[model samples]
Target: MMNALESSSTRPYLIRALYEWCTDNALTPYIAVLVDDTVQVPREYVQNGEIVLNISFDATSGLKLGNEFVEFKARFGGVPRDIMVPMDRVLAIYARENGQGMAFPMPVPAASDEQDDAAASPDESQTAEAPAGEPAARGGMQLVPTDEADAEEPTDPPPPPPRKRPALKRIK
Candidate 1:
């Protein structure tokens, strides 16, 4: 007999395995979800208390890549509905690679720091200019020629253009 904690730990894996099996058999596995109520305002969404088959892409910009939250369209009871879920929140991962395949459990979430470090110290390169003793640093700044020192100066503008072209004549 397994303890309650052990059973709980295995539950997600079992669900994933079933989903994969459905995919292998070319059967769509739907998930009945209790969506976060906060997201319902924009779309007038409804959970409808049934697992609906999700048909959407898994492209780079789509839901399957990883860590991306996505909104996809699905039809329930002949009415179109919008469903949003985070990839992390996915309970099952299934693919129809083989007819009647296998499902794998969703992985556990890892701990992460969500806070931004606005007060972190700046990098040395950003705060200070390198010393001139280094050869590389010496060539970094360009020298500008001053008008008072450099003597190759243009004194006058060229003559004005001709008002008209010479008339064409018959050649011998």
Candidate 2:
């Protein structure tokens, strides 16, 4: 049997499931993506190194949510643009209406990380880029818990409720 680290990534599958969930409930599904040279989208639409895409049936054409990528055609400012975002670049997929969905941890590899990897011995490279004791990585992607304590049961009390909502409120 394949070990957990040897298995494929679950990010793309989760994105597909969330997209279906949003559409089934009449909500707009939007994906927050981290822009990089590998991502293919209208550069003008990207803001602060990220871009949010609407992947609803009405918004995108030829949408293909594959294991490796999310390919589709979306319109930006009346111009139909082709979008191809790598699965790893997707940060979150949430319903625009209720803001309910999954938020994945963005894998921010250091600029010089790859160089160091290549220099390491073959066996050393097989281990996870994440710190020790965490889950091992599969290829270049690693799915780790948001908090180290998440791996075990919570012993502390829940966080206090927020004092107020976000500063920029939507009146509409």
Candidate 3:
């Protein structure tokens, strides 16, 4: 549990907390984002790979803030569009009225050469075989390499399994 907590990024938690704070005070919540190839937003609205968005309840619908991404539907120039932003791309979340909020460091991805060591060789036999979407296992799980072509590819994560409540029973 401790390891999980430490490994977990605090960006999502802080974003949710600040959003709630803004709404409680009747202030508009805004987010500043660094738009990368993975970000799904209106290209016209983005300038210099950065965009500021109004994320208040009135501005968005079906807002789902998750550990890996923030998903929502919002209107842009009278047209509704879906927006998906990776947690790492979020630079700051603040109240538009007072500009009071927190900013986080954007984690940089590792170099391609370092990440694609397993697939660098053209010879198929020389490369280790692993099923699609499954990470290579050495002694433990290893991170999978990502390609530039997959930058904007959306992932459909499986729903978490339901949990059963514990029950006490008498045993001989």
Residue 60 in candidate 3, Cα distance off native in Å: 0.4
Candidate 3 residue lDDT tens string, 1-172: 4786578888899999999999999998888888978899999998656788888999999999899999999999999999999999998888887778887875555556434753666464245555555445433344568889867756887688999843222111
Residue 121 displacement (Å), model 1: 41
Per-residue CA lDDT of model 1 for 1-172, tens digit only, reads 9878665444345445565566556655444233443232124433331132343332112323223443555555557556565433443333333223223343332323111211243353234454454333322333446786566666886789979833211111
Clashes of 2: 0
Across residues 1-172, which tens digit of lDDT does each residue of candidate 2 receive?
A: 9999999999999999999999999999998888988899999978767788888999999999999999999888899999999999998898888888888877767758766765776567665364455445633655445767556766897999979732211112
Global lDDT for candidate 3?
Answer: 0.80
lDDT of 2: 0.82
Off by over 4 Å in 3: 4-6, 112-172
TM-scores for all candidates: the values are 0.29, 0.66, 0.63
Q: List the lowest-lDDT window of 10 residues for candidate 2.
A: 163-172
What are the runs in model 2 whose C-alpha is more than 4 Å off? 110-113, 116-172
Clashing pairs for model 2 are: none
Worst 10 residues of 1 by lDDT: 109-118
